[model samples]
Target: MSVQPTSAPTWHRLSPRMLAIHPIIELGRALPALVGVFFAGHAGGHGLLTSLAVAVAVVAVSITRWFTTRLRITDEQVQLRHGLLRRRTVATRRDRIRTVDVTAHLLHRVLGLSRVVVGTGTSDRKNESRIVLDGLTAVGAESLRRELLHRTPVAMTNQGSEPADELARLERSWIALAPFTLSGVVTGLLVWGFAWRVEGESGVDLLHSGPLRAVGHGLDAAPTALAVVVVGAAILVFVTVTSVIGYVLAFWNFRLVRHDGGAVQVTRGLLTTRATTIERRRLVGIELSRPLLLRAVGGARTLSIATGLRVGRGAEKGGEVLLPPAPVDRARAAAARVLNGATALTVDLVSHGLRARRRRYVRALSGGAVLVTAAGVGWQTGGSLWPVPVAVVLLATSVPLAADRAAALGHAHVDGALVTRSGSLIRRRVVLADHAVIGWTLHASLFQRRAGLSTLTATTAAGRQGYRVLDVETPVAIALADAVTPELLSQFRRRPAPAPRATMR
Candidate 1:
């Protein structure tokens, strides 16, 4: 809704243009049901009328959103009253507002309208602390975004002294890294799900169809290695193409800006554009991560460790992403710029030493040994030599994996931040501010104790809650805890016993 400042707060309705956009959105959501009705009606030769009736009913329900929804912004709170059958009144104190997001889907953009989502920084999974108002004019949305986010914190930290507003923008060359991202896998799963739904609704076994059966027969007739190679190559090509397309569609004109009012803004997306503003005071740290595939190509991605945003399974949730899969150096530079320095990300991390390296090998080899033993048992019973060779190959592969895992393990404290890096499959280098550490935990398993190693975890309310420095020397772990939170750890620390008096000797 387009809210204007008045002498006193008053309820406002959503833009009239929403009447056009909501029905289309609702029809899209009802597509599965509509398709089911169409198939059933077609069998009875009444498809057209039945489908039309369902679509009309969905439109009618969608149109009611405009009539029933009302929003109001007062001096102390923002209120949204929505729903028809079951009324809901959501309110949030103005002081608790941590973020202001303005978004416009394809339909809304065509009508020059946007959606405003005000977040209160609550960690509730249900998102009950969020207030959403859709169907505001483009200008009105920008005005509201400024109005909500202009109130600077009482104690502002220095984000940067740079006078320029723009921080970074999408580069065309960076699109090459898109193919290395997992977007293709997500797209493949979504497509598979839709096809599965269609098969169930149509009562057809797609895998047993004539074309698929012929392809399966061909694959079976070919040599196993050749068939595997051919299928893997095809899947790789398909995934790469889809990933590139998805990247472009989502981040065509991406831009990041540091506003003068102590906030940073990210604006991106092609079909559904979004503008997200996060106050600088809420940003606790930044995370730089690289999936195995992307790391192999020297690419990385980054996310802002902010209080209001939740880090979900996806790469970019609530606009937490600072950069998408790009060159590792570029990612680091962007992260450094955002944090107003390059010290933490560039500092040398302390190695966990040979014991940690040996532990990684032991863990990796143990896992591989289990597979080898299982394969041996299967060979003894089924008299199949194929399993033995596969297991042997996996066991051999674990050697390099163990080495990589060892290489990825490191941690350091630099520039008022705790920097830690770990994992080989998806290596993450997190630079968490020292002030953000609320507590410390030290743990060691029997094997770790024997090796004089402990895992030190820094507990914080931001990001993932706890960041671990794995398999370091026990003494070093305790020292790190004391460094981060001296008072908190002093009480729990184990003090050394005094030496026996020399007089006794």
Candidate 2:
């Protein structure tokens, strides 16, 4: 149904694709509860009674979510109303809008559905971001985006190229690595391993009754240990495998088409799928990744962090990986194609100063220690003395490994792209907007003062700005920011036009 052209507030209907997403969401959320009910019924011999209750509840909840959810855009504002019982109605003026985004999960792929989300930066309320819109087909999302962008009044004249996705290859490889059955087993173990002590005692009692009564049976039994540990490991393996499988699901029928409107549309997915439309100028940064494992196969993942995403449910999770597990050349080509040389990039690891030398190894060592120690403790508490220490040692080994993975950052403007490398072991290549920077700052700490090192901070309208330091002369830091400062100032420059009155959307 079309949105009624009206001045008065009216409840509008969201796309059916939005409703269709409820079933998948419900299934994902209710899987644990479902398994519990099944085992509970068999163990407690309740037959169909308890099981039926769970089924009915699940169906009821899913149906309610699918049917009752609604969103509306009027002359003045956009409003999202959802929930059956404690209903939530979020309203915002059209003027507060900053960005809009669309994404499609692998599941959404099979159904030809894409999620469309809108983002705004104002915290007129609490720490909440602007409302997010979920579940729209590719075309509707495109139309909506164009309309919103046209009405939003950004610097349409200065718009550059559309943003690109980072980690697209890594995300794809992760999917290809998915072992669904194995992953499920791991999930079962993590969720049910704790339940086994209560398993023989009865699964039904735990669900209907909140208190869990621990039963001490044979702790040394191979089956019990195998059920939890071996099965859990297998589950992890499966998850990894499924991550690989995700590539197929997510990129199935993949196509990246350029529309005449200076935008890009990426359509891919297997079951209940999705498509996304990206306008050129909305991109803020491009992220590139070459994971340690993927490095062996020469894989590179790329994505973009655009004004597209906000922090909230639906589509506001910013920055989606554009190229999942593609060949390095292909991934780079795809990124370059989408960015058209204007994609934003971030510099995570610093190289121009002692910042890398001082904190890199220390942070890596501590991080490795904490991770390893936690794993070791978990293993030790499991009453297994062998795996606990083993886990700790393995984790401990990662400190130097991480350091090795990192690279030093030295940024230089190369053909409109700021390219730099940093991180100890995980070598990161930061490709960012060199000239689009909105602000810059230089600071020196007490230690930095002694070392004659000063940090250079570059600000953008994205989530945050980039911070880098140079250990060279104090003049160098200021010089480093000299090129950036003017750009930032120019972005904020005010025109001599007459002051205009602001009106509600």
Candidate 3:
């Protein structure tokens, strides 16, 4: 028996289940407003019936929205027509599509459906630039994802050449490094803020509640030193547990595959699964970022510096991340694979000189001294000597930090690639192709000129646009730019004077 090929879809409607789910999603979003309405009703501005009527109106609008929306997919474009009173149509050419992401939250997963987002990557406006088909069947969503991505003729041609190469997969052992990468302090603050918000809304004081009150009483009864230790241990445990859970949820079953068409696909997540595809051709460079704590454990994360991957306000986490927290060596290896065997990804960087090091220390110490002096003067007026010891400690700590930052600053060129490494607390190493560079900019501040140092910026059309090589000698910065793209800066190069005639002698 032979199987028949599936016919292409002309125009389609979202899964019928969307009729029920869309209203529920909208209602959940409006729940806070509904709550406010209920409170207002209880306060006698409106009655219970009024609140009920308002909610029903919201539900009616959502249901109407579901019925009015239609999706159409064709060889040339994916189009969406949505709206009730004012109909709006959005059409995006198939060729211009850069990312086709499939996301399924808990509700959609339970319903065996997902949301498909087809993006052009040129517009920052989410609704204007993308077509979202919500509540698509799991199978249908996957098919759409594949179809939309492989629509281009170039991609279709490449599809027959070879199978995708598996690049990286989640290793449970890497979870051990989670705590180092996690911002425990930030997490604690967020938790505290959330608790405070909840308490305010519910009219209950969390800190004064039963369990917390009992714990407070117990601490009050215990020795001060013991109480302090207990509190510290509890905070530590909370941070560690939160970090571990967050890491697991964000990276569960994480996998990276290099498709035959030279696109890197990333699929991961626990409760809300997300799959992102980044075309290798759009990739301008790779950045290996290591936070101070992660660096101590020899761990780093890799991000693709590419165009078209900047999704939603450009702050979307994991949008361009190729590797989660892993050993630096592993991250470098993965970067190399993504770059198609580009050795520049792992090449050693050239360090700045002693002058830069001294400058770093002097700047750090001077800043600290100014701050300390301000604090001391304030304390003197306030009749206190408390700022003296604090100043001493701060100035002392700045010395080693400055040294480390200076040591971390370096730049080099390898195999027609420009590499820059910098930062103290968060070490960033970027490897950019020389051909990607479009222009060069040289900057020297007043102090920098005196120090014979200048900063060179290599501007490109993709990635961060400008990658800087900082604190290099003026001549070195110019030489580096000339080496990368001789023609770009050649117009600004100084010419040598002609030799004097022999007859003058």
TM-score of every prediction relative to native: 0.90, 0.63, 0.84
RMSD, each candidate, Å? 4.8, 10.7, 5.0
> Per-residue alpha-carbon lDDT of model 2 for 307-374, expressed as tens digits?
44432221112234455556667766777777674433432333455553554466567776776677
- Candidate 3 Cα misplacement greater than 4 A, ranges: 1-11, 27-65, 83-89, 122-130, 152-162, 183-190, 217-227, 311-316, 491-505
Please write out the lDDT profile of model 1 over residues 1-505, one tens digit for every residue. Answer: 4355443768988899999988998998888778878888998999878999999999999999999998887767888899999999998888888888888988888899998888776432356778888988887777767767775321232222323378888999989998889788788888899878877776667787889888888999999999999899988988999899889877778888888877888888989898888888777788899999999999999888876665565765446788878898988988888898758888889999999999999999998899999999998998788988998899999999999999999998888888999999999999998888888888999999999999989988666778899999998998887887788878876789999877853
Regions of candidate 1 where Cα sits further than 4 Å from its true position: 5-9, 122-125, 152-164, 205-229, 490-505
How far residue 85's Cα lies from its native spot in candidate 3, in Å, is: 6.3
Model 2, residue 214: C-alpha shift (Å): 24
Whose lDDT is greatest here?
1
Residues 1-505 of candidate 3: C-alpha lDDT, one tens digit per residue: 0011123655566777777777788877766566556665676767577668888988898888768887776667777898888999988887777777788888899888898777665422434677787877876666566666654333344244436789999899988888887656667887786666556544556777889999988999999999999999998888788878877877888998988767788888899898887666667788888989999999998887765555333222536778889998999999998887888866777878988888899899998899789878888788567777788789999999998899888998887789998888888899988888989889999998999998899997555678888899988988899888988778877789899877853
How far in Å is the alpha carbon of 477 misplaced in model 3?
Answer: 2.0
Model 2 TM: 0.63
Backbone atom clashes (below 3 Å) for every candidate: 0, 70, 0
Superposition error at 195 for model 1 (Å) = 1.3
For residue 434, what is the lDDT in candidate 1?
A: 85
